[model samples]
Structure formats: C-alpha cells, structure tokens
Target: MPKVTMNINGRARSTEVENRTLLSTALREKLHLTGTHIGCDTSQCGACVVHVNGKAVKSCAVFAVELDGATIDTIEGQAAPDGSLNVIQQAFKDHHGLQCGFCTPGMVMSAAALLKDNPKPNEAEIRDYLEGNICRCTGYQGIVNAIMAASGQAVPAIAAE
Candidate 1:
C-alpha cells in the first residue's frame, strides 16, 4: 500500500491505499467524499471528474498513488465556507440542470473547469466543452442554460430556465 497525501477540499488528507486503488475509490471510500460518482469504470463517463492540481481529470482513470501530494478539489469544495452553493451550483439549481442528480457533481465540476478557462462560453462552446460529460436526463438544455447563466451570458429562450 502507498500513502497518498493530498489537500482535499481545502484540508490536508492522507490515506494508505493499494497501488491499484483508483482516485475515485480513495475519494469515496477512504476520504469519505461521495460527491464524485463512478458512473463507469472505463472512463467513457465523466462522472468521476475532479480537479487535480486545478485541472479536471477523470478520477476513475487515475490511481490514488499517482496523485500523491496533489491538490484535489471535489464537489464538496464548491460550496462556500458558509455552506452556500457556488455560482455554478446555484445556477444548476436555478436552471434545473439536474434530473436524477447522478451526473450533477461531475457536470458542475466540468462546468467550473470550463468557466475557469473560458469565462464567457457561448452555447456552442458550452456544448463542445461538455462533450466529455453525459447527462441522461434534461436533454442537456438545462445544463447548457446553467453553464451560460453561471457565466453571466444570456441563455437561449428554449432553455429550461
């Protein structure tokens, strides 16, 4: 077992995990951060997306040992210290971006990454940036609208929001 140390959700966390332990497993089982979902182990689904050193990476595809001493930001860290939802999260709720809520964490994380790199993404840009994430419900209209709204852009009228 390898000792993995990371700054998780703004706190220092260390855990001993097997070499084969996926980052998603270390997050969920060891660190007790359940917001990062594991929709598919094959990495086709972006359900396990998280910020590794400030970039979105599919946690399921990476081993915990590989990210030792990294800075990890999970969905749990998206809220304010006062527990208020962040802009992306609030927009998701306001725009009805989630249905079953399974993909929301990843969606929110990905949207955050997209907005960080491109603050004002158009509908097409948002759609293109979200190609890695899949939402089985809401047809992605609300999701797109949420991202747009979060970026302070005007969402199309057909959007759910």
Candidate 2:
C-alpha cells in the first residue's frame, strides 16, 4: 500500500491506499467526498471531475499516488466564503441546469474551473470547452446557459453580472 497525502477541500488528509487506487475512489471512500460522482468507469464520462492544483481533471483517470502532495478541490469546496452557493452553483440552480443531478457536481466543477480561467467565454467557446462533460439528463442547453450566465454575461433575462 502506498500512503498518499493530499490537501482536499482546504484540509490536509493522508490515506493508505492501494497503488492503483483512483483519485475518485480516494475522495469518495477515504475522504467521503461523495459529491464527486462516479458515473462511469471509463474516463470519457467526466462525471468525476475535480480541481487538482487549481485545474479541473477527471478524478477517475488520476491515481492517488500521482496526486500525492497536490492540492485538490471537490464540489464541497466550491461554496462561497460565507457558505452560500458560489456564482456557478447559484446560476445552475437559477437556470435549471440539472434534472437527475448525477452529472451536476462535475458540471459545476468544470464550469467553475473554466470560469476561473476565462471569465467571459462566448457561446461557441462554452460549447467547445464543455465537450468533455456528458450530461445524461438535461440535453445540455440549460447547462450551457447556466455557465454563460455565471460567467457574467447578459444572456436572456438572467442577471449575470
């Protein structure tokens, strides 16, 4: 067993895990971060997304040992400093971005990372960037709208700014 340490959701954690243990497993099983869902064993689903060192990554594709000493942010850490919903999460709720909600956590995490880097992404850019995320329920239009709204854009009746 390889003992790995990671800073998750602003807390430092150390776990003795198997060498091949996936990051998603470490999060859900060890740290109990169930908000990061495991929708697929394959990495193509993007349902296990989380921020590793401030960038979004598919948790299913990453090994715990590889993330040793890295800083990770799960959906639980996305809340505002006051413990209120973050802009992206609020936008998702306001825009009806989720249905079954299985893919929502990953979607929000990915959008948060995207908005962190590019605060004002256009519609096409938003679509292009979200190609990796797969939403099984909402048909994706609402997700795009939510992200655009959260990024501070004047779209429809939504007050993005």
Candidate 3:
C-alpha cells in the first residue's frame, strides 16, 4: 500500500491505499465523497470525472498513487463553502439539465471545466466539449441550455413539449 497525500476539496488528506486503487475508489470509499459517481469502470462513461490540478480527468482511469500531492476537486466541492449551489449547478437546476440524476455529477464537472477554459462556447463547441459525457435523459437540450446560460449567453428557446 502507498501513502498518498493530497488536497481534496481544499482540505489536506492522507490515506493509505493499494497502488492499484483507482482515484474514484479513493474518493468514494476512503473519503466518502460519493458525488463522484462510477458509471463505468472502462472510462467510456464520464461519470467519474473530477478536477486534478485544475483539469478534468476521469478518476476511474487514474490510480490514487499517481495523484500524490495533487489538488483534487470532486462534485461535492463545487458548491459554495456556505452550501449554496455554484453558478453551473444553479444553471443546471434552472434549465432542467438532469434527469434520473445519475450522471449529473459528471455533467456538472465537465461543464464547469469547459466553462473555465471557454466561458462562451457556442453550441457546436459545447457539444464537442461534452461529447464524452453522456446523458441518457433530457436529450441534452437542457444540458446545453444550462451551459449557455451559465456562461451568460442567452439560452436558445426550447420547443414546447
């Protein structure tokens, strides 16, 4: 077992984990930050996305030992210190970006990363950037709208149901 030390959600954490332990496992089992879901172990699904050193990475694909001394941010950390939802989160809620909620954590994480790098991504850019994240519900219209609104861009009108 390797002793890994890292800053998680702005707090210093040290834990002993097997060298083969995935970052997702360390986050969920060890740290109990279950917001970072594990939809698939093969990395095809982006449900395990998290920010490592400020860049989004699939936690299921990374070992805990590889993240020693790194700064990791999970979905649980995306909210304000006072427990209010962040802009991206609020946008998702306002625009009905989630359904079933299984993939919301990853979607939100990816959207946050995209916004950080490109605050005003166009529709094509948003689709391209979020192609890795799959939402089985809502057909992604609400998700795209949420990202647009979060970036301060006008959300295109959605058709009436």
Whole-model alpha-carbon lDDT for candidate 2? 0.88
- In order of lDDT, best first, we have 1, 3, 2
lDDT of 1 by residue, 1-161 (tens): 78989999889999999999999999999989999999978887798899999999999999999998999999999999999999999999998899899999999999999999999988888989888898877459999999999999887888433
| Ranked by TM-score, top first | 1, 3, 2
lDDT per prediction? 0.92, 0.88, 0.91
Candidate RMSDs in order: 1.7, 3.1, 1.8
- Itemize residue pairs with steric clashes in candidate 1: none
* Candidate 1 off by > 4 Å: 159-161
Top candidate by lDDT: 1
lDDT of 3 by residue, 45-128 (tens): 798999999999999999999999999999999899899999999999999898788889999999999999998999889989
RMSD of 2: 3.1
Better of 1 and 2 by TM-score: 1
Residue 64 of model 2: what lDDT? 92
Query: What lDDT, from 0 to 1, does candidate 1 have?
Result: 0.92
TM-score of each: 0.96, 0.93, 0.96
